[model samples]
Target: MEELINSAKALNAKKLVVLCRLEPGCLGPDGIDHIDAFCQVAERALVNFNADICHWCLAPRLDKSLIEIQYSLAGKVLSRDKAIKFISSFEQDLDVIEERFEDKLTQLINQYIARKR
Candidate 1:
């Protein structure tokens, strides 16, 4: 995860969206627990980095959707004098369900970049 974040920073990315997946036995009994643990990991890795970047995590197994993990305008490198925003107003605002998973991811990335700018 740290490597991925560093890579994004290296590429001058202003935002990052992570789709987290855990092996069956390695995760907690429920999705919320998994999300909590993932947040802990992200915090540790993100603190030392000094860049204006926002990140959102999506974990279907944890019952987290794209709309639920909107970015908060709280970064040093990528702050644009605006508040955090989601890719779409909400999941219902998206027609991504008709697209392939890869296409949906592409849309999310595009939306994030567009909204952040």
Candidate 2:
């Protein structure tokens, strides 16, 4: 994840967005939420870089089902309500998982930039 962030930084990106697929049936540090576990790993990954402009969206299920979308900014986790709003804007009925992921991520990145304004 840090390498990806570094690559984005090298490309002169203003912000970085990461969408993760949580492991199925796994438990997190929070004991029940895999997103929380994913967030911990993400935060640790960002420790070597300036994570202030990074946004993360964690999918509880596989990238296909996308049961939940959890957001983190600058290593700080946002409330599910707030995350839900961001996630909702990008939700659409697209069956192809790869294409849907690419499109949704693009939209989220755009939304992240717009929010900075």
Every candidate's CA RMSD: 13.3, 14.3
lDDT scores for all predictions?
Answer: 0.38, 0.46
Instruction: Show model 1 residue runs off by greater than 4 Å.
Output: 1-32, 53-66, 74-117
Q: Candidate 2 lDDT, tens digit per residue, 9-72?
A: 6653433344565554444233244445544554454443323433444545545555354444
lDDT per residue as tens, model 1, 19-87: 333322233344343445544554444333322333434343433232332333224322212322332
Best by lDDT: 2
Name the best candidate (by TM-score): 2
Whole-model lDDT for model 1 versus the true structure?
0.38
